[model samples]
Target: MTTITTRTVEYPADGLTMIGHLALPAGVDRRPAVLLGPEGMGLSDVERRRADALAELGYIALAFDLHGGRYLGDPEEMLARCLPLLADPDRMRGIGHAALDVLRTEPRTDPDRIAAVGYGTGGAVGLELGRGGVSLRAIGTVNATTTGRPGEAAHIRCPVWAGVGSEDPIMPPEQRNAFTAEMQAAGVDWRLTVYGGALHAFHHPPVGHPVVPGVGYHPRHAQRAWRDVVDLLAECLPVTEDLGA
Candidate 1:
C-alpha cells in the first residue's frame, strides 16, 4: 500500500459543525479528487477507511459528514433527520457543496478534475450536486436512487452510475423507474445495477446497531458495488499518471 496521510477536518454545513475525514496520496502533486459521503447514520469508520483506500490509489478523498460529527445509530433518529434532508434538494446540495469546497481548496487536489461517490443518503447528495450543475467528472452512488424535483435533472452535465439491491424495499421498482425516467428525459448518461436478492443497504457491512426492516448486508454484492464505483472513477477521472509513482 502507498504511504497516504489522513486527517480529521471540521466544516460547517446544515447549520452544524460537520466533521469529515480527508486522505491524501503519497506525493505533493495535485491529483483528481473525490467527495465521498456516508450513509444517513453518519460518518463512521466505514467511510474513513474508504477515504484511506482512495488515498492509497492516489486520489485525494474527503468523507463528508451528515450529522455534525454524530453517528446516529438509533433507527428512528437517523430517519428523523435524513428523511427531511432527503426531501430537499437544496439541503442536500448544501452539504455536498461544503465538502466540495473543502476538497477543491486542498493543495493536493486538481479542482477541475473531480468526482462524487457516496453511499445511502450520501449518494443522494452526489446526485444533487450533479443536478445543481457542479461540473463533476462523474457521479457514482450506491443504495440511493432518489429522484430530484421535476425538470431539475436536466442540469446534470455528467454521467451517473447507481447501484441498488433488487429486493430493496426502500428503493423499490417504482422509485427506480422514476429515477431512470428522469435521467433519460434529461438526456443524461446514466446506468443502474441491481444486485439479485439483496435488501436495502446491501453495500453496508453488518452493523451492530438497530436497523430498519429492509436493511441487510450482502458481502459479495458490497464488494462488487465498490469495484464498480472505482471503475467509474477510473474512466471519468484518471489519477494514475499524476500519482508521481
Candidate 2:
C-alpha cells in the first residue's frame, strides 16, 4: 500500500474561517490534483478519508469545508445552511475558488492539471465553478442536479460527468432534463448517469445521523458511483503518470 500524509488547512471564505483537510501522496513530485467537496451535511471524517484515499492514489487532494469548521448531523440544520448556499452562484463560486487556491498552494499539486470532484451540495459548487469560468481540467459530481443560468455554461472549459439516483425526488427527471438541456445548449461536454432503484444521496454511505426525506444509501450504487467518478478523472486528468491510480 502507498503511504500518504494528511493535515488540516485553515482558510477564509464566505465570511467565515473555513478549515479543510489536505492530503498528499508520498514523495515531492508535483502531481495532478483534485478539489474535493463534501456533501450538504458539511465536512466530516467521511470527506477526510476520501482525501486520504485520493492522496494514496498519487494525487494531491484537498477536501474543502462547507460549514466553516463544523459538521451538521441534523438534517434540518444542514438544509438551513445549504439551501441558501446552493441557491447562490456567487457564494458557491467564492467558496470553490477559495478551496482551489488552497489546493494550488500545495507544493505537490500541479495547478494546471486539476479537477473538481464533489457530492450533493459540494457537487453544485463544482458546477458553479465551471459556470463561473474556473480553469478546471474536468468536473465529476454525484447527486447534483443544478441547472446554471442561461449561457453561463459556455464558460466551462472541460468535460463534465454527473450521477444521480433515478428515483431521487430532489433531482427528478424534469430537473435532470433541465440540467442536461443547459449543458447541451452551451455545448459543454457532459454526461449523466441515473442509477435505478436508488434515491437521493444514494452515492453516500450510511450515516449515523438523521437524513432528509428521500435520502438513502445503496451500497452497490455507491461503489459504482465512485468508480464512475474515478474513471472520469482518469480520462480527463491522468495522475498515474506520476503514481498508480
Candidate 3:
C-alpha cells in the first residue's frame, strides 16, 4: 500500500467555521484532485476514510464539512439546517467554493484537473458548484438527485453522474425525471443509475441506532455504487504514471 498523509483544516463558510479533511498520496508533487462532500448529518469517519482512499489512488482528496465541525444525529435538526441551505443556491455555492479554495491552494493538487463528488446534501452542493459555473472535470453524486434552479444547469461544463436508490423517497421518480429533464435541456452530459431494492443512503454502513424511515444501508449496492463512482473519476480525471506508480 502507498503511504498517504492527511490533516484537518479549518476555514470559514456560511457564517460558521468549516472543518475539512485533506489527503495526499505519497511521492506525488501534484495530482488530480477531488472535492468530497458528506451527507446532511455532516462529515464523519465515513467521508474522512473516503478521502484517504482517494489519496491512495493518487488523487488529492479533500472532504469538506457541513454544520461546522458537528454531526447532527437528529434527523429534524439535519433537515432544519439542510433544507434552507439547499433552497438557497448561493449559500450552497459558498460552502462549495470555500472548500474548493482550500483544495486549490493545496500544493499537491493539480488545480486544473479537479472533480466534485458528494452524498446527499453534500452531493447537492457539488451540483450547485457545477451549476454556478465552476470549472470541474466532472461531478458525481450519490443519493442526491436534487434539481437546481431553472436554467442554471447550462453553466455546468462537465459530465455529471448520479446514483440513487430506486426506493429512496427523498428522491422519488418525479424528482429523478425532473433532474434528467433539466440536464437534457441544458445539453449537459449526464448519467443516472438507480439501484433496485435500496433505500435512501444505501451507500452508508449500518449505524448503531435507527435512522429516519426509508433510510437504511444496503451493503451490496453500496459497494457497487462506490465502484461506479471510482470509474467516473478514472474516466474524467485519469491519474498519470508520475502520480501513481
Candidate 4:
C-alpha cells in the first residue's frame, strides 16, 4: 500500500483552511519536501495523485490548496475566482510563502532541500516566491505564464523549469519566446519544454470549459512533464545516503 498522510493547514494570511496531503516514502528520514501548488481549479484528485507519485520517489510531497474548499466544475466560474487572486501580486506572494512555510515546517522534511511545483496560476505564485528569495532548491511550473520579463529574471535564485504546450492559446509562441529571452539575459538557469499540439491545462483530464474546446489532458506531455520534474528535483536537491533509499 502507498505510504502517505493527510491533514488540514490553516493559512494565517486569510484564516483559510487548506486541506494538505502529505506523502512520504516508507523507511525514509528527513527527505526533501516539495510544496505543490494546485492549478486554478484548486486541489483536485490529480494533484493528490501527484503528491503520492512524488512520495513514491522518496520525497515528502505536500499538496496545498489555494482555494478555500470550493471546487467549481465550470471553467468560467473557476476563472472568475482565480483571476482575482492573481491580480493582487502581494496576496499571491503571501499565499505562496505560507504554503512553502508549511512544507518546510513538516517534521519529515529537510528544510535545506525544499522545493515547489505549481500549475497554471499556481505556477505564477511559485515564481513570485522564487523572485522574493524563498531559498528553494528548485521550482517547476506547468503551463504557467506569470514569470516577469528577463530584466527581473536575475532575481530568481533557484533554477526554474517551465513546461508549456506549443498550441496553447493563452501562452503563445511570442510570449514563450520573450520569457526565454528574458531568462537568458538574466543569466538564470532555466529550461522551457514545449509539447507539440497540447493546449492549456494539458495535464488535466477533459472537463467543462466554455472558453476552450477540448479538455486539458495530454497523456504524453503530462507523463514527460512529471519525469522532468522528478529529474530536476533530484539534480537540484541531492540526497545523501542517509536520506536516500
Candidate 5:
C-alpha cells in the first residue's frame, strides 16, 4: 500500500471559518492534485477518506468544507444553508476559489495539473469554479445538475462529467435538460450518466437519524460512480512519475 498523509486545514469563506482536509501521497516533489467537495451537509469523514484514497492513488487532494465545519444532520438546516448559496453563483465561486487557493499554495500540488470532483452542493461548487474560468483539467460532479447564470458556462475550459440517479426528484428531467443545454451552449465537452433505480444522495452511506425523503444509499451505484470519477481523472489529468521526481 502507498503511504499517504493527511491534515486538517482552516480557511475563511461565507462569513465562516471553513475547515478542510488535505491528503498527500509520499513523494518529494509536486504532483497532480484534486479539489474535492463534500455534500451539502458539510465536510465529513466520507470526504476525508475520499481525499486519502485519491492521495493513495498518487495525487494530492484537498477535501474542502462548507457550513463552517459543521455537518447539518437536519435536512431543514442543510437546505436552509445550501439553497441560498446555490442560488448565488458569485458566492459559490468564492467558496471554491478559497479552497482552490489552499490546494495551489501547497508545495506538493502541481498548479497546472488539477481536477475538481464534488458531491451534492460541493458538486455545484465545482461547476461554478469551472464557470468562473478556473483552468481545471477536469470537472466531475454527482447529484449536481444545477445550472448557472446564462452565458456563464462559456468560461469552462475542461471536460465535465456529471452523474445522478435516474429517480432523483431534486434533479428531475427539466433540471438535467437545463444543465445539459448550458453545457452545449457553452461548447463544453460534457457527459452525463444516470444510474437506474437509484435515488438522490445514492452515493452516500446512511448517516444521522431520520434520513431525508427521496434520498437513499445505493452501495453498488456508489462504487460505480467512484470508479467513473477515477476514470475521468485518469483520462484528463494523469499524474506522471516525473511529477514526483
Candidate 6:
C-alpha cells in the first residue's frame, strides 16, 4: 500500500492556513523531498494528485497553497489574485522560503535533498527561490513566463529545468528565448524544452478548460512532461535504500 500524509500548515506572517499534501515512501528514515508550488488556482485536487504520484516514485512530496483555500478556474480571477504577489519579489520569496522550511522540517524529509517544482505563476515563484539564494538540488517549472530581473539569475545555485509549450500564447517565443539567454549569462545550469503544438497548463490534463481561444489540453505532451519531471526529480534527489530494493 502507498503511504501518504495530508495536513494544513499556517503561515504566521499572513495568518492563512495552507493545505499541504505529504507523501512518503514506506520504510524510509529520511527521503528526498520536493516542495510543490500550486498554480495560480492554489491547492487543488490536481496538485494533490501530483503529490501522490511523486510518492509512488519514492520521494516525499509537499504541495503548498499560495492563495489559502481559494481556487478559481477562471484565468482572469487567478491573474488578479496572483499578480500582486508576483509584483513584490520579496513577498513571493518569503512564501517559498516558508514552504521550504516546512518541507525540510518534516521528520521523513531529508533536508539536504530538497527540490522545488511549480506550474504557471508558481513556476515563477520557484524560479525566484533559486534566484534568492535557496540551496535547492534542482528546480522544475512548467509553462512559466516571468523571468527574474537583471542579475537575479546570478544567485541561483542549482540546475533548473523549464518545460514550455511552443504554441503557448501567454509565454511567447521571444520571452522564453530571452529568459534562456539570461540564464546562460548568469552561468546557471539550465535546460529548456519547448513542446510544439502544446498549450498552457499542458501538464494539467485533468483540468478541462477552454481558457484561451483555440487552446486546449494535449495529453501526449502532458504525459511526457510528467515523465520528464519524475526523471529530473530522480536525478537530483538522493537514492534511498528503500527505493533501491
Report the Cα lDDT for residue 80, model 1. Answer: 100
RMSD of 2: 1.3
- Cα lDDT tens digits for candidate 3, 156-217: 99999999999999898999999999999999999999999899999999777546788989
Q: Residue 137 error for model 5, in Å?
A: 0.3
Candidate 2 lDDT by residue in tens digits, 1-245: 68999999999999999999999988989999999998999988888888898888778999999988988999889989999998899999999999999999988889899999999999999999999999999999989979887899999999999999999999999999999999999999999999999999897788997899999999999999988988898899998777543
Which lDDT tens digits does candidate 4 get at residues 92-137?
7888877777887878888888888889877888887877767888
Which one wins by lDDT: 2 or 6?
A: 2
> Counting only residues 3 or more apart in sequence or on different chains, how many pairs clash (N, Cα, C under 3 Å) in candidate 3?
0
Write out the backbone clash pairs for model 2: none
Candidate-wise lDDT, in order: 0.94, 0.92, 0.94, 0.78, 0.93, 0.80
Clashing pairs in 5: none
Error at 112, model 3, angstroms: 0.4
By lDDT: ranked, best first: 3, 1, 5, 2, 6, 4
Q: Model 4 — which ten-residue stretch has the worst lDDT?
A: 207-216
Candidate 3, residue 233: the lDDT equals 95
| TM-score for candidate 5, residues paired by index | 0.97
The lDDT of model 1 is 0.94
Worst 10 residues of 1 by lDDT: 236-245
TM-score of each: 0.98, 0.97, 0.98, 0.90, 0.97, 0.91
| Backbone clash count for every predicted candidate, in the order shown | 0, 0, 0, 1, 0, 0
Which residue pairs in candidate 4 collide? 150-182
- Segments of candidate 2 deviating more than 4 angstroms: none
**Alpha carbon lDDT at 178, candidate 3:** 95
Positional deviation of 93 in candidate 3, in angstroms? 0.4
Q: Model 3 — TM-score against the truth?
A: 0.98
